[model samples]
Target: MLYFLPEPPEYAPPPRAVRVPAKLSVRVFPEVIAMSHPYELAPTRPLSFERERGITEVRFQGGLAHVEVRLPGRDVEAERLVLLQAVAEAGLPVLLIKLHPGSVSFALPDAAIAERAERLLLGRGYIYAMERDLALISICAGAMRDLSGVMAGLYDTMDKAGIRVAQTGDSHDALFALISGTNAEHSARLLRQTFGLPEGGTSC
Candidate 1:
């Protein structure tokens, strides 16, 4: 699907990207190019390894869950505050959140918290859904949103590898994808291979 950077006054410039050829690239990320246009994935930043782990260690964090809600309100910020308050009261750790027109999808630390969330949020002018056994994967880079084909390639990689994504969110700084906890390792391996990064850090 058609998915959605800056700065010239750099302290240090970003590394040149490795280009995926259109022919081989399209086979890998066919969903990226819908129209007859051309784009390039800018160079990746050569990571500074003071204590950097590189792309190895396909790590997956467990004990995560998500909650989706639809409430009628124009003030997104106000709604967010309300949701955060409710989640906090439930003793669940809120991870990432995405807001649509009147709908919001957010994640918590554990599935058991759903009981508190539903009890607290339901009948309070909101329809909500809660899910558990989820893992979050996020990639952050400078100006990733502005880079064309990057997201499409990501989705394509998941699709080919048979990774089922539970939810996705994006901001100016990062891209987040939630997948089955069981599939986290496979998905992480696919992500590492997709980016041509070195493997073997700690876990997968």
Candidate 2:
């Protein structure tokens, strides 16, 4: 006789029930978050031409010299580099550098530095021009690039006042014009009046 064995039925586990909270509470600390990540808040009101836009101040900086180096040959780039390297080696600080096809121009802070730069150029045999007794008129504002017609207005004002601008430069917040030192005070005053700034603003 043969014994018959039958396999038992497969066991099945019951499904698990998940528990979820009916109400969830979240706490936020603004001061702690701000302390962790510091940043400046933007102005609530949009920038306006009447209030927030336009020139904020007028500054006059005198006793600067404008120098232009002319490199007329085909190796203008190399000559320009050599000239700039010489200036750097002399421990001279140049500002408002502008490059041309065969020339480079910049401003020296004072007459003493200008003289030193002139000596360096003369020693190197570079053809250059140096204009002394120049002043930089800075039209200071917030976000100057965003303001339309600022440059035009400034040029118009200067032209009307018979102030001759030798060179010009700009930053994000200010527009600069190099003018005669003799006219710096007059230019500053006229710019202040045109831009509606106070008469007692800072000038040096």
TM-score of 1: 0.56
| lDDT of model 1, residue 130 | 76
Q: Number of clashing residue pairs in every model?
A: 2, 0
What is the C-alpha lDDT profile of model 1 across 107-186, one tens digit per residue?
87676665666677874768777778888876554455555665776799889988877777766655678888888777
lDDT of 2 by residue, 64-146 (tens): 99999988678988878887898899999999999888899999999999999999988888889899999998998877888
To one decimal, what is the Cα RMSD in angstroms of model 1 from the true structure? 24.6
List ranges where model 2 is wrong by over 4 Å.
Answer: 1-52, 202-204
* Pairs of residues at least 3 apart in sequence or in different chains that clash in candidate 1: 16-43, 17-43
Error of 2 at 18 (Å): 20
Q: Report the C-alpha displacement of residue 202, candidate 2, in angstroms.
A: 6.4
For model 2, the local distance difference test gives 0.86
